[model samples]
Target chain A: MDLTLDRIRLAYPDGDGVLVAVDDVTLTVPSGTTTALLGPSGAGKSSLLAVAGAPLDAPDDAAGAPRAARGPRRRARRAADRAAALRRERIGIVFQQPQLVASLTVLEQLELMSHLRGRPAASRRAHALALLDAVGVADRADRRPEHLSGGQRQRVAIARALMNDPQVLLVDEPTSALDHERGVQVVELVVRLARELDAAALLVTHDEATLDPVAARVHLADGRLVEAPAAV
Target chain B: MFLALRDLRHARGRFALMITVVALITFLVAFLAALTAGLGRASTSAVTELPVDRLAFAPPAEGASPTFTESEVTPHQQEAWADVPGVGAAEPLGVATVRASGESTAAVTAFGVRPGSGLVPGTGDGGADVSAGTVVLSRGAADALGADVGDQVGAGPLDLTVAAVADAEADFAHTPVVWVSLDDWQAVGARGDAAAGDAQDGPTATVVALRFGDDPPTADALAATDAELGTVTATPREARSAISSFTAENLSLTLMQVFLLAISALVVGAFFTVWTIQRAGDVAVLRALGASTRYLLRDAIGQAGVVLGVGVGLGTALAAGAGLLAARVMPVVVDVSTTLVPAVVLVALGGLGAVLAVTRVARVDPHAALAAR
Candidate 1:
């Protein structure tokens, strides 16, 4: 499925006013394509990724101001519920750290996504095993996160993200903890899996060296998209 | 309970330690509860098991409390209570702690009542009555004195033969009871000086036992009669407090049991509070994965219930076994109320404590998981 963020904007409260995080950001990533969002630290790359993944509330119609409706209260409860449902149904998020639940094994971690979506674990076993095989860690399916290496853990996390067949896959600095070679290989694997699974992939990273594997790249500065780079 | 079950399996050492703590607390709670019930029974079974509905004692002095030890009822008070409307039968009952001997000597509560009265079990039949020098011993009293029917036993100042043993077992103030006639009791208690003054005024019966029909005496009428006659009337169960030693001993043991229960709850709360804090990161991750607050709460409480159930079950079993063993050597009585009630209470209170602790999961911020914090 294709994901389109039409004029999406986000902001946070500053000392005396509000600071824009994603300024009128309009972007689209069609199925089977990998888009890397790159910028310096504090460039609003994470904010844009967060907005796309439905983790943060959408920006207000007002310019350079945070939407005042996102605070926790009875009035904003319906909006929060809708946002939560969106995340549950159509979004898959991978954090900078593996973020693997330590108690679950590799296979169970993947199965948990299906379980969250209301599928029985027994019925999802074959699919979970298949995803584990696709991620090239099927042999370690029964091992917990503590038993796996950093690269292997990230692979299991990737498999878990795809377990629900989410429409949009959001990657947040997934290679931040890896070496140069390992980071490059992880990025390549994400690109390959995104294409194979026909997912609209958004890769957010500060490491510019890993952008070579992405099909397209976007740059953001000071909460606004500076320019849209050509497709690779 | 997907994550909950996995956590239990993965953190076996930590959960095992928690379960052990719960087990020990449950063991103490169940044992104390059983002991409390057993001791209460040993102290009050004689009065509680009586056929009469109420007992009347002599009224205390101004600003004083009425006690079985200090209260003595006169024949006039007994007659007044007997003549009260709706009072079917009223019998004089005397209770005194005295030394009784057969082959060996032991302290026993001598209960003085009329032979034909319903108060003494197996007395209306061909069973020998307590005449001048005869007494009926309860099975427990017989066991304590190592004496049987046709054996001789000695009370305060008189030697009496054990005519027949009563079938029902009753105890008062942790002492076996020996049933004797009211005349014999008065003879034994009368002082040489008091007996010489007025034959009816020497130490009278300790209390008056009353039986009520379907239409029984009202509490107001009973109080009025007691006020007019200078006496106190109480239902059989309410009269337990009149036994000063039983009341004090029971309160202390019961207070300890209550304290133990409170400590169990606090221990459970503290343990789960730390467990929830340790897993705050995992909770945030689950929240970010679209797990609702309700779902997480159910999972946490269900996990706690599993632990409590297992721990309480094992502890109750151990308590029952220990109670059975203790019954042989002590005044312990192992029954369903003493064992099962405590197990159920421990699990319920432990679960409540756990729920209080795991509610912190609702406050965890999903954004923290994104920060790798």
Candidate 2:
């Protein structure tokens, strides 16, 4: 397994005490595979994916299963800076919305990933172009987000997530705004990209119809994972 | 500044409006600064540009600053100052405004200096001949009276010949100057005491010009001399306040410039504050994408710096052109102090406002981008 979660727990401040968002959920997704977390609203599917992406710091001594200790490099990078470097170097996140920067073009969106890691974006132009080509949005590469359709923007976002060739891809509802057919197409596209890039993908979605292309499925409810009888 | 440049290009209209506001403020500040300096020169050039390092004025009332208007230094006071150690040359300078009738009549300040005092610009170099009954006219005074060298001018009960026109120009109380002998100034009945031509103990001139030869008197020694002579002394710069018009005019103009500077800073701050708040969602997305807080702040401030540089550069150029044109009809100086100094100050203050506004980037949570919009 390229990505592992050992009883990951996450909580947020409620009115007085704490409201646990994810509790004692241990899961692993091997490389070149996609795992779909299927649950309804408030099921903590997004929270688990967020933890795997390392956006929210995993609580120490969480559920008597403390997170893996940081190595020398991670220890030296300092809290937020460390997380940011982790995301920039190893984890790729796809938000619920396309969330394309209004000022950037489709091609520049991929180029920005390289820029964030303190590399000259121009140095990776060929790779960025190849990613866009792989995602089948090469024709719309020069267009701005407003000029692209909803499905096209999602594809461009997928291409951007793979720009740095991250090891773990965490996608949250890639087709939330799409219709049935487009939703299936986007999920299939994510599976293909994850396999081709040989990256472990954890996708959070409540749409059961889109799970056919996903390699495995897990059920979550009220911040805890349920044992699915037919673990497909 | 990659994102910054793109954003600026994408939102040209908003940034253009901000740049215009900054430019207009810079124009107003630079122009006012030039006018203030010019007006100051017109009001006190004659006194400030004197050849001596210091001027001794009759002491004012208790707890009051010295004034050239009310000061009256007598011959006895002048003699006392001349006898002081390190006193190189103490010359009596009488300042009085009178009407001069030459080819035309104009109000002129008669500066009374003894022969070979070199208090006038053209005296030592033979550019002007300052004998009895002959006056040396500053270029401004010559132009005002339409009198050239060897021309005769009637200066308040004294018929004086313009022996030579001085190379430089000086003004006092906004009137052109004409150098006259000490006797001629006394003959005009503009002395402190009104004796109507009878021999009387009266003020020789308004102030005495004091020049240090090799070793100037120490501050303590000068203070002691002031106490002994019942007088007060000031450097040429400090004496500028003694001119009644200069003090009021300069203070008002300087205050206006200061206010404009403050307004520019607030305007820049307000503009960037609104811009930052409006784009907070974008900032969150960027953070989630792994952009450091330091990177975003640099991009924002670099954008502001580019705008300020262009706007202030254009505004300063406009002021210089306008000042050149305005100088033809009025007093307006266009120089480095008036233009470049104000521009640098505007950029600094405006940059500070931008820094304050963009610091909010650090507080944006990257997790917010994970939620559904």
Candidate 3:
């Protein structure tokens, strides 16, 4: 399924005032395509991604402003439950850091996703191994994150996110810790995997150098989405 | 258990340390349980092993409790007990501690009864005649005296022959008992009391052992008889506390065992509480990755179960071995109450502590996993 973030809003309060993190933000990533959310830090890139990936109750409390209603209170609860279920089965997320479980081996990390989805581990072994191979870390399948290099860990994390063949892939600054050359290569790998798997990919990043493989770039200045590049 | 098992293997040193603590606590609890049981046996077996349902004693002064050491039931009190409605059998139980000399000499609690009162250790097995001069010795008494039937032993200047050794084991105040005739007991105790210038005039004994029939008299009837005769009666179990020093000693050991059990649970709670706090971040990541609260709790409890089972199992085995060794030189009874009960309790309470600790997994904010560290 395609991911649609219709005119959603997120705001925080600042000294007797509301600071909008996202304002009427509307965007979409169709199947088999990629959408790159890029901006400077504090531009609400992460907050907007949170709204799309894990829908929560809009903040309307001290130090925060009201968010656009996803629906009624009961409906919103159902929606959040629906969203959680979707995340388990259809959405894949990659945080800025590798964040691979310290105890899980490379292959086990991906298999864990299938296990969470209630799939038999034995049945997913070959698939987990194949995903690791696709990310160029097949030989390191038996090794834990402690022994792997930073780039290798990121590769494993990427493979783990894709283990369930998600419809929407959310990438958050996956190359922030890698060297310039390696960063470019990691983004390229993500782009290639998204296209090969036909997943609607949303890549959040601040590095301009890594935008070569990102098909569409949506910029956020202060919680509001700027128009797509004129190249569109 | 996927995460639980791996976490244990990855952090073997930490888990092993916790397991050792659990093992030692289990060992302490099990060992103390055995000791309490053994002491209880030594203190009250002589009374508990009696065939009667209850023992009747002359009431103490206005507020004092009934005690075997101070109780003295006369022939009149025995006749009153036997005459009570629903009284199946009432036999006088005369008890006295005196030094006896045989192949091996030791202090023995001499039990005095009628020749055919059927209170002797091996009554049906032709134990001892309990006539004027012969006495039946319990296994422990015989063991201490090193005497067989026809062997002679003397008690307080009174000579008697050991008629037979019975398989029963009886003790009072940690001393084995020797069954003798009421006449013989009166002769011996009478001499001692006379020599001490406090001899009683008539036949007197310690207490009257009673057994109730199928249609036993109600409590009201028993109370009326007691009021009329000015006596008190207690079930075998209640009478056990009347044994000198039995209550205080048993209470202390039991209290210690209870404290050990409570301490083990608290220690387990403290350890897991810290463990859970230490891994809160990992828990957040797991929850963020779609692992449900049930899954996390199961994993944690499974980890605790492994720790408790292995630890308690090891500890019980050690305690059993220790009990076997201790039994030879000291009073220690190793049985299910000492081993299995403690092991089960350790696991249950340890699991409870773990549940209290890991429930925090339910409140972990999956959103935190997205925060920049």
lDDT of 3: 0.82
Question: Using alpha carbons, what is the TM-score of model 3?
Answer: 0.91
lDDT of 3 at B38: 89
Identify the runs in model 1 with alpha carbons over 4 angstroms from their true place. Answer: A6-9, A13-21, A57-82, A228-232, B124-128, B189-197, B201-203
Q: Candidate 3 chain B, which ten residues in sequence have the lowest lDDT sum?
A: B188-197
lDDT for model 1, please. Answer: 0.81
Docking class of 3: acceptable
On the 0 to 100 scale, the lDDT of residue B44 in model 2 is 90
Clash pairs for candidate 1: none
lDDT per residue for candidate 3 within B330-370, as digits (tens), equals 88899998899988988888888878877766556556776
User: In candidate 3, how many Å is residue B64 off?
Assistant: 3.4
Q: Which candidate leads in TM-score?
A: 2
State how far residue A57 of model 2 sits from its true place (Å): 6.8
Would you list the rank order by TM-score, best first?
Answer: 2, 1, 3
Between candidates 2 and 3, name the one with more favorable TM-score. Answer: 2
Model 3 lDDT tens row, A106-130: 8888888877767765578998899
Model 2's DockQ? Answer: 0.39
